[model samples]
Structure formats: structure tokens, C-alpha cells
Target: MTGDPLAPRAAPLHALPPLPPECPLPMPVQALGRGRIANPPRPTTPPNMAWRRFGVIGGVVLLTLVATYQMWWLLRGDGIDVLEGLLLVLFVALFAWIVQAFVGAIAGFVLLLQRRPLRMGMHADGPLPALSTSTALLVPIYNEDPARLMAGVQAMHESLDATGQLARFDVFVLSDSRRPEIQAAEAEAFVALRGRLGANARVHYRLRQDNHERKAGNIADWVRRWGGAWPQFLILDADSVMSGETLVRLAAAMERHEDVALIQTLPVIVNGNTLFARMQQFAGRVYGPVIAYGVAWWHGAESNYWGHNAMVRTRAFAGCAGLPELRGVKPFAGTVLSHDFVEAALMRRGGWALHMIPGLGGSYEEGPPSLTDMLVRDRRWCQGNLQHGAVLPARGLHWVSRWHLMIGIGHYFTAPMWAMLMIVGVSIPLLHAGFSWGHFSLEGFTPTAWWREQDGDRFIAVFVATMFMLLSPKLMGWLATVSDPAMRRGCGGALRVFVGMLLETLLAALMAPVTMWVQSRGVAEVLAGKDSGWEAQRRDDGVLPLRELVRLYGGLTLAGVVAAVAAWMVSPALLAWMSPVVLGLLLSIPIVALGASPAAGRWLRTRGIFLTPEECAPPPVLVRATELRSPGTNGN
Candidate 1:
């Protein structure tokens, strides 16, 4: 068995070798102490970044003020009632979130049009830079597919070797898997990977007996054992893949900038094989850039980490980025679930600069193959983000860092807020016992006479304005895409790109209510102290059995039907107003089922609808990964 490389391996291949001896590098659990580190190291930030921040924040506030005033006037004809007051409150809160994104997209659109680097001193367009210091590529995974995981690593290994920088970097696969058979497969896969790469391969594998903090704990374990050997390390998700050139430039940037602690690259979604995945891939490919550029422009050196596709200074991370056990119960207590935001905050608190570079290409990852699969992942994310509430008030966090944490928390709350708004809006007609606004003439009641006279035009105006703020990002992203000849061609021309955007928008509208309902439930559960335990993600065409789909979405469909009947009974106008949300809920089962159909995805791809640039012309690294990703291929 030892002599022949092709010989079949036994059960020992299911388990990793004895744990490696510790090369201890102290990573003390940081206290959520008061105030920024005393005498924090001040790193240089981009010029005019403060102005950029002012412009973005100022724009959001101004737009919100104007919108809120109009809404107040619309409902103030007879003074706001309780339900009206609640509606107005939700509108302002949700509208502010929309306006912030709109303003940021505008900033990103301008930056993209300028065709300049997003971050200062970052050169992404020229020759690949050479690396002087050694870097480690750390991929932390748990209970993921062995074949797919090893294939991506092999592809990255080959890409780096082609860059002549293979000697300057090492790859580490840190596993937190608990199953004996799965661990065996992981070990066998790695053994095969090393054999295929020959004797000089620098890849290493380690398994943790304890899974304390899940992914965060796995990485901390690595930092304690071997982090001192490398000056910088790149964190990669199991699905993450980057070009050799992008990896080299990231390392070179760290070497050139001594004070910078981390650099984040925007990982574009690729390899989408289902309709839902394709929609996500197209959106991220077409619209994601502008958003990233906008955030990075204002975020400056105080940027955030997305957990992966980011390189961090080993010393800085070891010295300042240790995560503390959040003091709380169940969901919020124990290990911080959303560790990335807190880690970035702590690093920033220690005065280490963190930056996001979006223009530099080559970073890529896959999207959830279907909505059902996506929601499973989102459930965990929802819990993780909700847990950040406990971290938001930690002493000395930069205000921007606090904003980032708040954004994460709000991401989940907005769902319930949305659902509540719809529920309350529909409940108004029912509360009156009929559609007659003239039913009540008491003081502190809605002004039915005034509403009857001016409601049509005012309603139209508010609706139009809200839709504009919500959908302008898609328009801006499309315009930016079509303007670039190469991108336009890659996306199957300008007309197809336009059509794709419309199709994606329609599907998104149909799916939004379902998402809101599910996320609303998820938020409630998290608040009620429910934990989203770890589960392997579905990475393929997510088609499910009809029974399963019904089991998942039956209640939502029933709720939609009941809501529609109630709205139609009250007034056709109310039904019309609630159609978008009701229709989505009513059709949740079919919509989800269709979204998981590989055939539906293929049909769209064949028609040139929802075609992303990556689909039209995949990069070399992605092409290689696909070539090696099959089960029996690449010695797996």
C-alpha cells in the first residue's frame, strides 16, 4: 500500500495523522476593553477619503430628510393615527436603508466611470508584481465535499506555479470536520493532491479535535501553531479561487505598505449552474462592482473583511485580532458567531489599516444553486449577524466599524420590518371593517374626505419616488456594464444585458416576499434564542422533490392565499396594492422549485438570458478548476 501510488487506500485515509507539534504563537483572547488602544498606531489613509465619507453620508441624510417630509405631508392631512404613525416610522427606517445604498451606488458609478484605482498605491492593471516575503494560503473548511475542495486547491496550486511565485507561498487546508469517514476522505484527497503535485509541493493539512468557535476557532488554532512562520496569510473559503497574479499582487502590496494590516478583494460569483445561481451570478457580476467600489472609496483604510479572499498581516492578526467570547446566552453568548466584523474592528482599534480593493480582478466564488439552499446559508448568517449586537458597543471601536456592525444587524431586521409594514398596511382596511375610509368621523382619525380627493396623485408620487430609489442601482449597473465594449460582449451584448436585468428584477420581486417571510421567521427565532447549527452547504443544482418543496413552502402559500382573499374582500384596490407581495407568497413553492431546476438554468443560458461575463468567457483559473472538479478526476 505504501509502495504504489495507485494502490487503494484503507480506513486510515479517513483520519488525519497525529496532530502536529505546536509552534506556539500567543494569540491572547482580547478583552472588549474601553477606548481605542491607548496610543494606537496611526496608518495613512487615502487623501480626500474623509470628503468621500462626508459626501456619501450627507447624501443619505439629505435624501432621507426630503423623502420623510413628503411621507409626513401625505399622512398629516388629519394628523397621524397609531397605525399611520407605525407605517410612517417603518417607512422612514427602511427608506433610510434604501437611500444609503442608492447614494453609495451613485458614488460607485462615478468611481467606475473614472477608470482609476479605488485604493491609493494599489496597481491592479499592470504587470504582475513579484513577491519578496513568504505568504500562507489558509483554507478553513468543515464537512465540505472532498472532491470539490481538493480540486480548487490543485487548480490554485497550478496557477501559482505558473506565476513563478510558488516558492514564496504555502497552502494550508485546515479541517474541522468531525465524521470519521469524511475525515478519511479529506486525508485521502490531500494525499492524492500532493502526489499529483510531486515532491516539491508545499501544501499541508491539519485537523482540529476541538471545534470551539467553528471557522473562527479553526483559524485561531492555525495562528497558534504555525502563524509565526509566515509574515502574511490569505484566508480563503472552501469555494474561493483566485488567480496566481491576484495572489502575488496582494502579498506584494502588504510588503510595500508596512502599516497596512489587511487587504480585501471583491470575489466575483462564478460557476453558476442553476437559474437562481445564474441570477445571483449575473447580479453580482453586473451590479456588485459599483457597490464594492462605492464602499471601498469611503471605507478607506478602515474597510471590513468578508471572511475570505482577504490577506492579513500575521503579526498584526496575532497581536490584535484575537476574538473574545461574547458574554451572553445561547446565540449571543460563547464564541462570537460573526467573527469577521469583530476581528476587523479589533484590528482597526489597534491602529492597523484595513483596505478593500475591488478593481483588482481574479477572485471568484460560487453562489447558492437555488433559493432554498441560499436560505439555509442565510439562516446561519442571520444568527451570526444578530449576535453582532453584543459586539457593537465594545469600547474603542471606530464609529465606521460600529456602522459596519450595525449594517450587519440591520440586514436581518429589515426583513421583519418589511413584513410588518405589509401586514400593518393590509390590516388597516380590515380594522375599519370595510374599505370605506369614510367609516369613521372621530377626532384623531385619518382624514377620509381629504384622502379621497388627493390620495391618487400623492400615492403615485410616493410610489414612483420609492421605486426610483430602490431600482436605480440596477439601472446604473446596467449602464456601466453596456458602456464597456468587452463586458457588453461578454454579457451577450447590450440588449441581452438589459433584458437580463429586467428578468432578474421580476424574479427578485416575486422572491422578495418569500425571503422577507423566511428571514422574518429566522430573525424571530434568533431573538428567541435559537441557534443555527453548522451544516454543509449545497453546492450543486439544488433541485428537490415535490414533497420536500411543499413541506418547505406550504404554509407560505396558504398565508398568501388567505391574505389575497382578505384583500379582495376589502377592495380590489387593496388587492392590487398588495399583489406583488401576495403573488410572491402564493407562488413560493413553484418559484422555489423552478429556481432549483438545472434545466431552467440551461434554458436561460441557451437563450443568452442571465448570461454573466464569467459564463460567456471564464477565466483561466476557473476553467482549470472546472476541469479538475469531477469526482474521479485528479486522482480523487
Candidate 2:
């Protein structure tokens, strides 16, 4: 019936060769020897980008300084006791984090208001351009649900075929699944996907026996074996889906900008069926753009890369992004966990431009379905980001690259810092009550605000300013949303959008202490040399049994109760001051359970609450993926 099963079919399939067993390309592991890359190529940096960088950094520094001064004035009344000094240090560190985010969000708000199309010779809207070079869509999976994996692949392939760029691209399902049953299921899914797409489809699957370094290693194996065949490659997480138009645009952008090694797209979280997931989806949709745009605008050619939904120049990646095993024991040593950030940093160090286009739509991924799931994932990420402390010192990395690494590290560290701040805050009052140190006074602490009174007024002003900085970013996102007619309509009108924002904010406040505790625990574990081994993420409804929820969050509730009682015994004013943290900790279990509830999610959706554009009016690719993943449709 056939001369060779691996032979290409007539017409469409003939444009690209069948997957080869061995097409060797040298992908030497990059050396960390302390030196800059000799005569590295010059990347084309964005013009006037210095001003943008200065604006973001300057704004952050100025605001942080002002907040620091205010805190100092408020605490300087009694000559700054030991407890007060510790409190001030924590306050300043935490306030700096807040200020940095606020400044970035403000920049994003301005960028969104301008609505200027980002240029690197790539336009988000317009007729699609034809791609000249081949691109391999690399989907790396490990013990994941095969049906969901194949569903995304089929969706993207079908979408790409619609754009007539299918011939220029190939799909590779790279698996690191260790379970024999899961491995077999993956093969079956690949076969089923191929059958559905017909013989002309250029989809292939490979299951590696040795899953060295995990996902990063799987991609590298592909690069060494078959990377020479393609000029570009786009990495997709198991749940990633991108519209055909976006894929073509990314490839064409790479073609146009040869010096650019990577381009990261803003992936909107979709298909969240749990309340927790929905909250995450809504926040990401509403506030994500401004935050992303602000970073992208200022970052320019030195932007960071997320792990997936990004296109990369194969040669640049092979040459510059080769990762070496860190020489250490367990968690902080060996294979890089958060490879995307490190890869981008390395590529940029080699003088290749890395950019993120947050304005470019059509990229999507799903969120962890529950708070528990989120915490588990965050633990692994926490370790990975903390490991970046090692890479930060690598020679020749741009200051911005170092900043990105620090930001990643800080993302985890701040959790502990916030938790410590609350702890210190609670302890201060507890100590005063326990040791009989007498009542505190705010007599001479006046740093007069333009329209405030002396003592307590200064305290009120400082507190208000801190809260304002914390909440202003959300307000900016809400403003941006209401201003856009299409977005507003998609998010269930300006009223529902505002309602959704408020609900999300309230829920977040209640969840804040719980999150802080979990992250603090994660940081502590990683620091204590515990490794977060690879585990497949839960994709279905995340509702857990009441007992399970209790087991997970009981300690937090007990802590909250003790803190509340202690504060109450001390003074009612102290209790009031600590209520937010105490309340959140007290309700941790219910807050997490509510987040994991699919019933609650659906109930809210019925009322147009927590709506995102993807849910309201999905792109065709997402719509197709849903159809293919229906119970009877997928080959499973």
C-alpha cells in the first residue's frame, strides 16, 4: 500500500520534509567563565528608550523615597526603638516593592491610553504576512493529560492551516512522561490528532527515555537533533493555544528583525471553570495589559521571556541559550527550573534583542484551578527563581537582565517580607502588652501634610498614602477597561467590569494573608534545601473535600486566632490595626475553598461577573479547541 510510511504525500505535505531521526547541530553548553562574549553582534536598540527606563526607575525611586521619609517621620517620635527600627526596615523594603509595581502600572496606563502600535516592523492588526522560513511548534509535556495536550496542538495546527502557513510549520509533541500508561496514551493521542488532520499534516511525537533537566533538556534535545532544519521555533506549554494569524505574525517578525533572538507574547488565561481560576483570569485580563505594556515599553530590546507562547530564533537559542548544570546540591543546583528568564538574559548578553509585545493578542494559557494548586506551582517557581541568585553574577549580563533576575527572586522574597512585616506588627503590640512596656504615644511624630493635623493625622496620611499606592494600579486598569468600548462590552459592560474589579479586589484582600503564608513557607522550604520535583498540573475542577481544605489551611486559621486574641487582649486599637491580616488568616480555608468551587464560578458567570474577553467572545482557535476536546470528539 505504501513504499515508505515515512514518505511525504503529494501536494501540501511535500513542502516540508518528514521528521528526521538525526539532523545533528552543535548546541554546546554555554560556559559561565567570567567574561563578555567576544565581539558579539550589536542588537538594534529602541530609540529614546533611555528616557522610558529613566522614567520607570526614577518614578519608582522618587515614590519609594517619599514613602520612606513619611514612615521615618511617623516613627521618629520616640527616637526609633529596636522594634520600631525593625518595623521601619521591613516597611521600606515592602514599600519599595509596591512603588515599583505602581510606577510600572502607571507607565502601562499611559501607554495603553496612547494606544500606539508597538513597532519592530511588526503590526498587531492588518493583513497577515506570508512566512518565508520554516518554524517548528515545540510542545513539551510531562505526565500531563494527553487529551488536553493533543487538543491544543490540533487547535493550533488547524488554525495555522487556515492561514495557509501550515506548510511552513511543523508540530512536534515532545514528551517527558515517565509513566508507561501516560506515554502510551500520548502516542495514541498523537495518532488520533494526525488522523483527524489527515495524512498531509506535519505533526510528529517523541517520548524521551532520559528526562534530564526536565522541560529545558527536552527542548535542547530537539535543538541538537532537529533544530538545524528550522530557522525559528515557537514553544508552547501543554495548555498553550495561539491563533494562526498570531503565529504567522511572530514568524514574520523574526524574519524582519534578524538580530532579535526572541519575542514573547502576552498570554491571556482562559477556560477557568473555578472561582479561583476565574479571579486569576479576570485580574490577568484587566490589569495584565497595563503591567505588561509598561514593562515592554521600558524594557525595549532587553525584555524578559516567559516559559511559553514565545517564538525564538533557533540558531541564537542554540548558540547563546545553552544552559549548564549549576554545581550545587539539590534545589539551588543542577538544571535551571525557570529557564525562560535565564535564556533571555543569556541571549541578550550575546547581543541579541529580546522583546515582548503585550499588545499583540491571540496567545492564551490556562491558570491553576485552585489556590492549593497555585501554591504547589508557586513552590516550584519559588525555587527556580531563587536559583537565579546564582545566575545574577554571570559576567556580561546587562543591568536590565540582572534586574529581571532580581525581580524574579524578589517576587518570592517579598512574600516572606510581607509576612514578616505583619508578624513584626503583631509582635510589637504583643510585646508591649506582655512586657508591660506601657502605652505608645505619637506626640512629636508630626510631619505635616498640607491639609492634615499634628500627631495622628500624620499617621493617617502615611497609611492612606500606602493604601493609595497599593490600590491605584487596579484603579488604572479599571479606568483603561471602561475607556475601551470593545473591552468594556467584552467584560460585561462598564458596570459589571467595575463590579468584577471590586469583587476581585475584596477576594484578593481576604486571600492576601493566606498567599503570604504559603509563599513564605515555600521560600523557607527552598532555603532549607528542599527541591520541588516535577508534577503535572491539575486541569479539571479544583474543588477539594472539606477535610482536605482543613488539613491544608488549619495552621493558618490557628495562627490568625492566636494573633487576634493577643491583639484584643492588648488593646482594641491594636486589634483594629491588625484586622486585615487576622481576618484573612482566619478565613483562609473558606477563601481557598470558595476559589476552588466550580459551582460558585458558574454562578458568578451567569451574572456576568469576572468575565474576560476570551470567555465573552473567544477567538476561533479557542472555539475550535473546545469543540475538539468535547467528550466524544477527541480520540481518547
Candidate 3:
């Protein structure tokens, strides 16, 4: 068939339209022709990846072995009773977990020192190429406050519009809200947002009748329906916000690198008003980078995804990341709660690359306002992570992917293990005091003089070593910030940063026992077949009342007192060692109440304590985001 003379010539399949002035062509794009584009070669596994893996594993194993030996030496001939044996096993497991983290931190420090970009072959100095494909920006909402959600959406939309590349992207609010009132409010907000942006605005909203699998199913539905229209999609949480430049750069990077299936940007915590939130914000800004970079350095093409604040190729996601209903019932089976890691694993299992870029900036999210809020979230996460046991045996997963799943599972398990270790430690002395309780007693005990002679010093040494391993990552993070002049200044200089670190450490120590108990309870509950049902997170909740605090922690305080008295009866030295934990639990009510106080956070901010770079020198996008307010809506 002959074409009409007036017909416009069709654009070549590989050809991309001319980019705006802001979107500079990178080296990779410079090589592409109008009709033909060169696809970059797939990333190869680093030559030293095997050695790095071995080094991390060997380091953890060596430290564990040495620690175990010391522990054995300390406990030897103390009549190796059943309680003692259980204690040793728990201690070894906990020690190994901490050692693995220590090794990972050391590796991250070395990588940071090298000053290499986390994006393997991508250069840091070059300009990013313009995007050649359409992208959909998806914000999934549950029963969140419509005003807050719309505010974030409006800010992001405006930011993208300012980039002049807004035409290449569309915004969608995928609501899974169950409340009729919340749904009506969401609809009003969406309409207001669209009207404000004019008819040319690309923002759209959809509410699902049934949130089948929750967030995962919500996104899967989007993928099945509208996903085919776009080549890539960026996922955002209700509290998430990304700069226009960052979004465009992410798109450009995806365009340049065909082998990568997903890229997760490190989302810095911001907008914290409560003391608990401020502490988290400070830690995330100052120390989170080192840890993230370290993981990224070794993770390379197999890094895990964090659900939101990330970009994924729609085709790869649709084909590979369709999650299966887990084998059994509620808690351990059914729908996966923590779906990010598993989705990344499935993507990698299909031979697609998953990566993290810790160095990239302008991605932000909010933290839970109070400790109670955090625990509530943690309870759900704990159940989801425990469910990963079923996914661990899935065939065709990469070794690194399996390691990621195992690490996640191990995170929750550590809490219960630590709790068990403490119980055993306290009980050992009770057993020594000739207190025969049930099956555990010091009957017919054989004493090794050598072990008894050196036990105190050896025990002290093990204690010091464990403390070092636990604290080393924080130290490394502080060192990383101090090494950079700009970062140091942004964080209120060296002295202030050091003081802040000290305070943070003390507060963390005080909070550890409380978290331990809470997580342990969560694990127990999950194991008891009680599912953490999908509930809206309490993001903006205020400081809890003193009465409610007491009500929540009264049992814990009572247990702490009893335990303290029991330890004192055992010996003053044991009491001293257990004091930190006991005291923390005893003071749980006050600690939680004070920590959630916005006034206290403001006081700290005024004193230049726990101040983050983002707080000190706010980014323009962040400023804009904070300024955007949601319109009011009446309940249906």
C-alpha cells in the first residue's frame, strides 16, 4: 500500500525525541544514533565479589568461634547443666548476628574510603541522559489522612512540573482505603489537586473495592491494567517525596542502563517534630549512608528493594515479581507482609538486576512520631519477616538474594534470642546460689579450678568485645561525617556531633530493653498464629498520656523490679551488669512519654542537638513540600 503524500513519517523505534536543556546527554547517550540505540552490556559480577563474600562470612565465623571459645572457657566445668547449655547456644547465635553486622560495617567503611560511586559502571561527573520512555509515578494509600497524602502528592507534582519534563510522567493515587469517609475525603482531595493543576494535569486517582492482598495486590492490579502503557513506574509511600531532578535523573539512568531492572534510592528521614522522630532523623542522616553504601558496595546487582521511593521497570516487575499466596494460613503464610525483599528476590531469580544508590540525594520520607507507633509498625514487620521462612527454599534464587532473606529473618529472631540470653545469664547466678528451680540445679557439680580462676577476667573481656562490635558501626558513621568538611559543618561541627552521638547512644541503650521485650512479644504472638492485621499506621499521633503509658508498661515495670531484686540477691556485680536493662524497663513509661514530646524535640533542636543536615539547611524541594497543605473535606 502506498502512503498518502500528506502522511507524516513514522519515528524510528530506537529514536528518542530531543532532550530539554536541563537534561544533558551523558557519554552513553552521545554514542546513540537517531534510528539505532546501543544497549549497554549487562553488568558482570565483580571479580572480588566471591572473596568479599568469603571475607564477610569468614570474619563472622572466626569472631564467633573465638567468642564461643572464650564463653566455653568461662563456663567450663561449672557443671555444664541444661540451663548453661541453652545459655551457650543462645549466646553464640546472638554473637554471630552482631559480628556479621560488624563485618558488613567494616566493609562499608572501606568502600566509603575508596570514594567510589555505588552505581558500578556509572560515572558521577557526567550529566544524565534524557528519558526515552514514559514513567508512571504511583502513590499507594491506605486509610491515611487525605490532607497529608494530598499535600505530599501536590508537592511532588509541582516539583516535577518545575523540571519541564513533567510531560514524560503521570501521577496516580491508588487508594485501598476501607472507610467510606476516608474514601470520600480522598476523592475530594484528588479533585481539588487536579483542578488546581488545570486540565492539562496528568494526575489521576483510583479506589479499589477490595484491597485483596493489600499494598502488593494494589500495585499488581495497577500493573495488570495500566502498567502496560508505561515502560517504568516509580513507587512512593504516603509520606514519600522526591525532587524533580532526582526523578528525571532516575529515569535517565534507567534509559541508559538496560540491564538494571530496579534502582532503590536511599530515602532520608525528615519532617520529624517529636524527640523520638528527631533522634531517628539524625541517625538516618548521619549514620544511615555508611551502612547503606556498605550494603550497596557488596550488593551490586542483587541489592534488596525497600517497597517505596524506588523505580522499577514495569515489564520486569509484571513478568517476575508476581507474588504467590504463601502455603499455609494467617500469620506465617497467606499474603506476605514484608513484600519488598521477596519481590526483589523474585526479580533477581528471573535474571534481572536490582540495585541501590545510596549516594543519590533528594529522596525523603517521614518517621513514626513515637516509640509506640514504631512498635506497632514493628509488630507487623516481624510477622512478615517471619513469613520469609517459606520463601527461603524457593528454587533458582541467587545466593545473595537468599542471604538478603536470611538477614531479614535473622533481624527479628535476634530479639527473642537476646531476651533468652539475658534470662539464662540471670539464671546462671541463681543456679550458682544453690536455688534449685525445677529441672535446673547445681547438683553433683564438678568444678574446674582453671575456669573458675580466670572466669571473671574472661567474662569481662567478652563483654567488652560484644560492646565494641555493637557500637563500631555508629562510630564508623560518625567518622564518615567528620571526615567531610561540608557534612561536619552541616551537622553542627565535630564537638556538637560527638555530644549528640553520646546522647543518642545513652538513649539507645535505655530503649534497647524495651524494644527487645516488644519485639519478643511480637515474635511470640506471630508464632501463636495471631496475624498482625492490616491497620493504618499511626504516623502523626501525638505524645501519649502518662496514664496510658503506665497502663501499657506497668507489667514491664513490675517485671523489671522483680528481676532487679532477684539479681541483687544473686550478687551486686550481677545486678550492676543487668542494671541498664532493668532500669530501662523500669523507666519505660517516662522514657516513652518524654521521647514522644514535640516540645522536648524543639528544645533539643534549639540546643543544636540531634540536628540533621536536612533540618539545618533545608532543600528547596523539601521547603516546597512542607509548604503545601491539603484542602479540607467533609466526611461522607
Candidate 4:
């Protein structure tokens, strides 16, 4: 009789047989020479690449200098208080962050304009190379809908079969679900899927009794039990979908590059039906490429892995990416929530090359359906990223790896920092009542005389510069889209794309205040030692109820009102300046509710507004994924 597949086995990782010679697996130190695998030689950055890096750095420096000069000039009054000084420092820090993104946007603009290939560490010069080794495709699922999960898996499996290279790959559904009902549903779905595909199908499913380290542990368990069976593995999230050709290419790339540990493809947002989701989908499809290419250009060998939709060398991952329980209690300690970045860092530390290929397509994932859902996800990410503060100073880590960690941390920290900056700015006028209003007049402004006032002219210049830096990236993304005829047509032509951009920008601005408050609260909660426990993502949660919306954003709206009133109490001019923030906050409930409406999204789709290339001409894999109905009632 056949034993239960879910039962744990005694198979140790070391007991697995060695890979064939053609696979070129990286051997452990004991198998090679001494108990130490020599560090692989690092690739030298090309002269042009070095210059690009320098150009980015130079641009940031120039912008930061201009901002700093303006800030200093603004605070040059005789009666400048401690609050004003603190505001200046915060402004500098915040402005520097803005400048960094602006510079990167410029780099992205240049790269897209050149239309050069973005394959950084790829070896093939002509046609795609043939894949020589086998790869295991892993989907580590939590308490997700069984039918939905199986549908995606089935679509991918069928796509791979269509490529005629299905023998080279095996698909595994590694479940970490704790609910009995969910587990039963998953088992039934798996059985039905396998039954339909026949016995020759390589699709397999396993449910772990003990979900030790969550997703990371789920993957690690596979590595210990079956990772040795394959030369490489592609990690995928529950919502992730990739085409057969893309999968074959990724496998071929890994097979050709022996030193490379990981290759991350750009996963475009797809299947978003809500207004918020559709906006995100459009922005991701349009602007994501430019930003991704810019980052890939700089992060050649030390690139990061984004957990899902990426392939990794099995041996490299097994040998180097075994995560240790960080020394702490909860949240900032214990199992790392954001394991992808740390895994990449560990792999790079072991001298394995990591790269992100932005030029490659066919990878797709879903976006959050609502603002509330997005914030929930962001809170967990905030904790995970902040936890990387401990890993940043680890011995033997490359500088680039540390930079990745810092960038992750900075992403969340910027929210709180901006909140603090706004708070300080509002209080400055109230604290120093002696400040003159004569120079702060909005009418008939004289630049030369206003500059002599030490605050008004400089503050206006700084505000304009800040806005420019903030919006320039979107403009670059727009330029990149319109410049390409195919892309332009795919996004509903120039006029529609332009209109869509304007709408997206307006919605983004409205949402910014709400997001800022949510994130700031998240940061505060983390600081207060609160842990963001793992929860299943609500992928198909359409529009939320009005009461729920009010509950989520009522406090934000109140805060905005209070802030606006406080600003008005300080000065009418300050109140006018703070109108955007105030309006966004006061209108938070309706904004969120309307944005979460699927009807609005459908209306936009009908009008061909915010149309993406993938939506216009759906890829076969995506079409299949959507067309295949869920096998069970669990889909809803």
C-alpha cells in the first residue's frame, strides 16, 4: 500500500545523490577542499555602469545641496527657535530621500530612452539557451482558497506543457494552512487536479503539520526533504502566475550561469478589478519598468530576491540561505517576516551572484483590492523591514546587500518622518508669534525683496522644488510610455493615457495623507513592541461597507480636521498651504469607499481608461488562469 504523501519522512538533505556533472552544482567545502568554499570572484562593474552610478549620486548631491541651501536660507532669522532648527533638519533628511528617487527616475528615463537590453548577468548573446537541468516550482501557500490556488497551478502547469519542456519541471504545492476545513478543501482540490491531469502530471501537494517558520520554514522543509532532488527551484506566491516561455527562459538562464544564485523577473500587476487595484495595476504596468530597469542597472550582481516569481539555484539556496531565528521576542525578533531580502543577502555573502532582469516579462501578480487591505499588508512589511536593522551590520555582508536593507527600512520610515515634518512645520508659526506676515503675502510677490525676508521666498522655492522632485518620476514614466508606439497603443493611445495619468495622480495625492497616517501609526505600534501577526491576504475582497470604511478612516478624518483648524489658528496663509493635506484627510472615508468600488473600476475599463498592455492583449497564461473556473465551492 502507498503511504500517505503528507506524512513526514526521514530523508535528510545530505543523503540525496549528487547532481549530474552537466548541472554544475556548487559543492560544499567538505566535498571540494577544506571545510571552506572559497568565495567566488566578484564581477567588476563596467565603466559605463560606474559612470551611471556616479551620475545618479551626483544628481542626488546637487539636488540635496540646493534643498539644504534653501532650508538654511529660510531659517536664517534672528529669532529662530528650537522648533525651527528641528524642522530644518527634518526637511533636509526628507528632501534627501526625495532627491534620491528623483535621480533614480532620471536614470530610468535615460535607460528607457536608450532602449538597450537590461539583461545584466545573462550569458547568452543570441537565441535562448536550452535548459539542461531540472527545476522544482514551489508554491508555499497559507490559508488561501483551495480552488483559486489550484486554478493558477493548473494554468501554469498547462502552459508549461504547451512549451514541450514539461519534463524538465515539477510543480509542488507546499501548504502551511492550519484550518482543518481549508486543509480538506486543499486535499480535495489537489486530488481533483491530479485526476484531471492524469498520473503523468508532476503536480504534487503536501500539508505540513507544523508550520515552524511560516513560509520560509515551508520552503526550508522542502529543501531538506526534496530540494536535493533538483538543481534549481522557482519560488512563487499564492497569487503569482508566469508564462511557459518565461519559465523556460528563467530555467535556461540559471542553467547557463553557474555562478548566479538567483534571477528575479519583474512581476506586473494583473487582474485588479477594484478602482484602487486598477490604478495600481496601471501605474505598475506603466512606471514599474523604468524604475525596475534603473535599479537593475545599478544592482547587477548584488540584486535582491522578491520571494515569489523568481528562480534560484537549489544548491546555492540550500547552502547559504538557511535562516536562523533572530535573537529577540516577537515582531522585531524571531522568524524574519521579510525573508527574501535576507536570503538574497545571505546568498550574496556566500559569493553567489543575484540579479533582477527587468527586460523579461510574463510574470504577474495581483494588487490589494482596497486602501484598507493595502495598509494591512504594509503594516506587516513595516515590521519586517524595521527588523532588518539587526541584520544590516552582520559580518561578511556586502555593502550592496546592506544598502538593500536600508532602502527597505527607509521606505516605511519615510511615512513617519513626513508626518513629523508636517507636525513641526505647523507648530513653528504658533510657537513664534513674532514672525512677520508682511513678507508671507501670496499676492504681488517680489522675488528680490522676498528673499531678504529670510523665510517666505525660500520656503516657496523649497516647496516647488519638492513638488517637482516628487512628480518628475511619474512624468518620466509617462514619457517612456508615450515614446513607444506599442506601449502607447496598448495603454489606450496618447490621449487616454494622459487622462489616466492625471486621474491616477489626483487619486494618489488624495490617498497620500491617509496612507501617511496609517503608516505612521504602524511605525508607532511597532516601536511600542506590538507584533503584526500573520494573516491571510484578502485577494478578492471588493468594495468595503460604509461602516467599515468609516471605522478605518474616521480617526484620520478627525485628525485632518484638527490639524486644519490648528493651522488656521496659526495663520490664514498656513491654512491655505495645508489645504491639500486637510482636504485629503477630511474626505478620507468617501475617497477610500469610492476607490474600492469594483463598479468604478468596470466603468474605467469600459472606457479604456487606465488600460494596460496585458489587459489589452492578455497573455495566454493569464487568459488560461482567468478562464479556468475553481474546481470547488471554496473559490468564493
What lDDT tens digits, residue by residue, belong to model 2 across residues 325-440?
98776689999999989999889888889889898899999999998999889899999999998898899888999999999999998888877776676565445434353653
lDDT of 1 by residue, 1-636 (tens): 459888666436445434435666888888785656533444558888768899989988998888888778877876789998998899899999999999999989998888885454667667778788999999999999987898899889989999988999999999999988788888888887877888768788887899988999999989989887889999999999999888998998899888889999999999888889999999998999889988988998899999999989998899887888888788878888778998999998888899999998899999899999999999999999998988888898888989999999999999999887766665553554343556422222332333444466766677788889899999999999998888899999999999999999999999998899889999989889999999988888699999999999999999999988866655566667678888999999999988988899999999999887787788888988998986566542
Residue runs of model 2 more than 4 Å from their true location after superposition: 1-18, 37-44, 429-454, 634-636
Q: What is the lDDT of candidate 2?
A: 0.85
Deviation (Å) of 527 in candidate 2: 0.9
Residue-level lDDT of model 4, residues 1-636, one tens digit each, is 789999634333233233222323333311111123236665523347557767777788888888888777777766557877888888888888888888777777888889876464453233555677899999999999977888899889988888888989999899999987787778777776776677557887787889988998898888878877798999889999998888988898787677889999989999999999999999997888778877877777888889999999998898887787776656787888898998998888888888888778889999999888999999999999999987876777877788899999999988888888877765564334444444333332222233345566666787788999888888889999999998999999988888898999999999999999989999889988899998999997657777888888899889888977765655566667778889999999999998889999999999999999999999998988887753433322
Q: How high a TM-score does candidate 4 get?
A: 0.89
Ranking by TM-score: 1, 2, 4, 3
Q: Which 10 successive residues of model 4 have the least lDDT summed?
A: 28-37
Candidate 3 per-residue lDDT, tens place, 491-593, comes to: 8888888888999989888999899999999988998999898899877655877788888898889989997786565455566767889999889988898
List the candidate 3 regions with Cα displacement exceeding 4 Å. 1-41, 44-47, 118-128, 436-453, 630-636
TM-score of each: 0.94, 0.93, 0.88, 0.89
Return model 3's CA RMSD, one decimal. Answer: 10.5
lDDT of each: 0.85, 0.85, 0.80, 0.81
Task: Give model 2's TM-score versus the native structure.
Answer: 0.93
Task: Indicate the TM-score of model 3.
Answer: 0.88
| Colliding pairs, model 4 | none
